[model samples]
Structures are given as C-alpha cells and as structure tokens.
Target: MVCGPDVSTHTIAFNTSFCHLRDTSAEADSKLSTLIHEVTHFDDTFGSFDSIYYLRESRKAVGTERSKVKTNADSLAGYVVWGEVFYAS
Candidate 1:
C-alpha cells in the first residue's frame, strides 16, 4: 500500500511472492525492508507514527553523507509496482 508521497507509507506483504527477478541475499534483504516499512503503515494503531523519521534519523547517526544519498533511497521500483497492486485492491 502506498500511503503518500509525503511519507514512506509504501508497503508489500510478507507472504507475497516476486518472480522473474534474481533471488539474491541483498535483493531479499531489500525486499524485506520494503515489506516491513509498508506493513508498518497498515496498522491503524501504529499508522500515525512516521517510519521515515526514524530511518532518516538513523542514517544521520551513521554519518551517511546526505549529499551522496538519493532522495528516494528506500524506494525500490519493484516495491513501488507492488504498492500499486495494493492500491488497486
């Protein structure tokens, strides 16, 4: 589910499968993060919380140079497509 462009509310389910893509560990981890990020949005009880806030804060703590990071660092195109699927549902 893509929540908003204003926030990182996009998500995919854990049970959902992906195909035609190479199954590698990094890809798996990236997908998992995308899932967790999106699932966080689906819970009404926790939906009000901002996931991106923590993510950006954490990145800052790690000294990641903001100048080098893409604005859509967490957005995977496949995940975005999956989000569209959720939107249609």
Candidate 2:
C-alpha cells in the first residue's frame, strides 16, 4: 500500500492482494478509516530512521501482517494502542 502525506489529500493505492483482503463489502466510512490508519504509518515514518528501523525489524517477526494476535482490520487500527496497553499492564 502506498499512502500519501499527512496533508488534506489522504490518497492511497492498495495492491491487488491488499484490495482482496480489504474487500469492498465494507462500508465506505470504514474503508476511509482504514486509509487514515495507513496514513498514520506514513506519519510515523515520515522522516524518522528509528521508526523505519522499527518497522523493518518488526516485519521480520510479524512478516507483512505486523501482528501475531489478529490480522483483521481491527489490528490495523488498534495495534499501537493495544501494544501500549498490554505493556503497561
């Protein structure tokens, strides 16, 4: 997936595999929210090597999915929140 900068235009283009996983059966608002979620990734890695390095290392463990718990849309939205909460406990 290619996400645009954090400006007004939150444009994103998903590859065929991603499109298949993120089926169009979902509501438009939900899809838009998913796009916003992806944009957050761009926001995190905008110009930070540490963030990029973290992503690279994480991918090795989680592969492309980035989560060992759940690979659903919820993971995309809540991974960071859940990780922080889980670690705080």
**Which ten contiguous residues of candidate 2 have the minimum total lDDT?**
47-56
Score candidate 2 by lDDT. Answer: 0.36
**Which lDDT value does model 2 have at 15?**
52
**Per-residue alpha-carbon lDDT of candidate 1 for residues 1-89, written as tens digits (9 for 90 to 100):** 23333334443434334343234333233444444445544444234334223232424422343332222223222224334321221
Relative to the true structure, candidate 1 has a C-alpha RMSD (angstroms) of: 12.6
TM-score of 1: 0.29
lDDT of 2 by residue, 1-89 (tens): 43444444545666554554432222222344445346554543322112222222333334443343133332333344334321121
lDDT of 2 at 44: 39
Tell me which residue pairs clash in candidate 1: 11-38
Clashes of each: 1, 0
Stretches off by above 4 angstroms in model 1 are: 1-29, 48-57, 61-89
lDDT of 2 at 31: 44
